[model samples]
Target: MEVAKILHMVGGVGETSYALNSTLQKKAMHIAKPIVQQSISQLYCKLQPTESLTIADLGCSCGPTTFITISEIMDEIYEVCHRLSCQVPELTFFLNDLPGNDFNSIFKYLPTYDKMVKKEKGSKYAPYYVVGVPGSFYGRLLPEESIHFVHSSYSLHWLSQVPRGLEDDSGAPVNRGNIYIDDTSPPAVIKSYVAQFKQDFSTFLSLRSKEIVSGGQMVITSLGRSDVDPLGGEVNCLYGLLAKALNSLVSEGVVDKEKVDAFDLPLYAPAIEEVKELVQNEGSFEFYQAKVFELNWDPFDDQMDDFVADSFVSGENAMKTIRAVMEPMLANHFGGAVMDALFSRYAMNVAEHLKKEKTKYVNFTVALTKRG
Candidate 1:
């Protein structure tokens, strides 16, 4: 299957759409906002472009927060200029994602978005334009030195493709009956995933290096693991349960076991040091700040307890979150017939697990400044 062509969140604003179910992603963005603001503020003061400031949001999937992000960025720029007592610059924003992303869903709300902005910014507002760019970030999509600030949130953990070498000399998959890494996975499986991440991330930095001007700033946030073991992170537990759900369907004769064995997620949540090392090796940017943090699987839950109070509701919420981000790819591979049954079992499994012990998603965020 062509992963790029199929790799988009469940589109439209239906009950199951990413627009409604992206609270966890929104939470992560909030956590990273300070870093984003700091980087942009420093860059603006330094360049102080007379005419305009250009910004890009890579992997800018469509949702409520999609436009909210642009609004916030412009608001930040306006606030800083107000304090500095200087002329506010016009702005251009590029929203970039793969071709299959719900760009139309994003475009639908543009008129209302502009009207709201005009009412809010009446006199002090500077004009801004939005353009959608469709392509892979693993390769070049923009011209040289055209971008001044770049912000990517809850992206970059996705590898360009599934890791190779999960199969053996006989062309049999070594990590069978699993969609992702687990405790029983061989050394080959772990090595294949790590190596793929290194290659893809380096390519990403090298491409962005050409597009961003000297002295530009970037803030990137993605799923990450704090554990030294690549296979022992929060993501493993999340996908491992998903594997269990699929295997149950196989046992019930609803899904083919071979299909389960053949599928693997094209994602990796790396250790924080891995990211820092690549930024240094890529030779394009300096890390102003690098940090790791965690959030509950239930986005609305803020309790400090290791055990959740309402496991059933949290389980349901968690399933919606995962379904929004993963349904398209799963349905494409496994056939849409099994989606509803699969996630029903998944929601129950999650509720039982939550009752036992609460699990959180680990994340890493970095603020960067480009070198001359």
Candidate 2:
């Protein structure tokens, strides 16, 4: 599948839209806020008397979390400017995502966002301007040395495309019956995934190196694995369950098994060591800090004590979240007719899995500065 053409969150503000089902991503942003603040704080401290700043939020899908991130970064910059007794810099914000993303939804909400920023920061607040840039971050999306600070959250795990060569000499899917790397996947499948990640990450760092000025800071947070055991991570379980759901449909002859075999999700969860190694080899950025944290699969569990008892509620929310993000790609590949049945099965599987274990996603946050 051509990821750029097909990959986008379920659009609009309807029941199945990303805008309504993105609490998990919002919680992720909340957890990574401190790292973002620290990165922005250092950027301002290192470059005082800054007259203007340009910021980009990569893979900023349509949602409130996009503006929430902007507000948080601006808050830190405002504080830093106040301490330095300098006027807050005029700001240019870039909200970037795939071309198929719902830019219209985000644009519709911008007037409200501008009003909130003006009221909170005062009408005299340096003009804050936002523009939507549509493209993949795996390549250059901005002019050379245009950005001072860059931030991406809950993205980057998605590869630019599925790794090439997942088929045998006879042209059959090597990783048959699986949508992602799992325990049953062969070594060749694992090797293909790692190779793709290394190449893609190298390209990403290279592109960012040109777009960011020397000494500019970047903070990225994404799903990751904590150990070398690729199949042992919590994310693998989610995919495994999804595979089971698909296989169940295949068994009933409701969906074609060959189609399932041909499909592979373009996602890879790298370990922190892998990221460090790639950045070091790329040689354009120095790692400032890296951290790993776990978030419960159900982000709303904290607000409710009886999540386990209300398994249906938890299951529905989880299903909606996954559907909002994956439906576009899945529908494009598997046909739109299968989505309702597929997710219904997926929800039941998730609910059953929840009863057995409290799965938590491992998230990695890294801060880097361009080498001078």
Candidate 3:
């Protein structure tokens, strides 16, 4: 249930959610659809004529984009089936998210799909059925050896929770900021996160190995940073801006600064090397293809045609929309008491950033594979 709840928190109609809904979804889809198609082609190439292909949309937040991803997969399947003279395999789609996700919203979109399937009855397009599995992907959410393809977008980096000991003062001394970055991270924070990723990925591979059958394929893509950042480091820029706003509230006596800093923002951005290490250790999946792609995806980036589209209109309205979008996250991240103050800080910063820093280079990563 916490997983589901967190999905809603991340996907619900708020600043973070709105950004996902408005900008991030569009950017992710542009890259994800094509890569998924490529992965499907690769999978089909290694498949036997008698084997049926299956697909899954993992970490699918609540939105039509999920359907779009599924649609692309189906289209790819359709094309491959036609070319290879292979019959459309019975398609079983597992739409997975946390227990607190907006399943109802996601489910509502399924009937239209079912209706389309009915209209095409007796056709060879393949029968596709979608069912919601509410649980965490860090563990096995599907029956072993039952899936043909697995895909998750912009979702893998978030750990179940912040790494431990980053905030604790029980030992030598205490500090603020992310624990994994602290100079005194108990010597285990990084290892712990990496270990968890290894374990989670191992379970993913082991379960997928069973579900995928031999020769099946899986494609996963999400945000990843460079192994080495010559600059300060890889920071979740949006999250950092958010943190700054929250901290500003605390400094202004509008919220508790200590609590704001203490609250861990659940996220992780591993490098390509880390990804390689995880996959190499698992050994269940063969290294098919891997690459770090620079995606021009962030809406807030300078490439936007309308950074301040409403210059002619009152600045008050623009600020209002921004506040509407960010308030919920501030409230959820900090608390209602200081939510307004936090948003105010964010608004001031955004106004200043619009006038100063504005540029256009947001990057992402893509990884493709086949069942080894």
TM-score of each: 0.98, 0.97, 0.79
The residue-by-residue lDDT of candidate 2 on 275-347, one tens digit each, is: 9999999999999998898876676776433347566677777888899999999999888999999999999
Off by over 4 Å in 2: 303-307
> For residue 279, what is the lDDT in candidate 3?
78
Tell me the spans in candidate 1 whose CA falls farther than 4 Å from its real position.
none
Compose the digit string of candidate 1's lDDT tens values, residues 1-372.
Answer: 577889999889899899999999998888888888888788888977567999999999998878867987998898889888988899999999999999998888999899999999889878899999999999898999999999888879999999999999998888988888899888999999999999999999999999999988889999999886897788898889899999999999999998888899999999999999999999899999887889998888987579698999999999999999999999999999899999999999889899988999999889988998
lDDT of 2: 0.89
Candidate 3 lDDT for residue 162: 52
Tell me the whole-model lDDT of each prediction, alpha carbons only. 0.90, 0.89, 0.59
Candidate 3 clashes: the total is 13
Question: Which ranges in model 3 have alpha carbons more than 4 Å from their true place?
Answer: 1-22, 48-51, 115-124, 169-203, 227-234, 296-333, 337-341, 347-364, 368-371
Better of 2 and 3 by TM-score: 2
lDDT tens digits, residue span 1-372, model 3: 132344343445454453344455556666666677888777766664645666777777676667777778777877888898877776778888877666777777688876775675447656667888887776677676677678877667766655545534454323354323333334455555555555665666666666666666777776666644312124444344456676666667776756655565445666777677777777777766665654322343434553554322322323444343334434565666765566566556555544444322233545445444
**Order of quality (lDDT):** 1, 2, 3
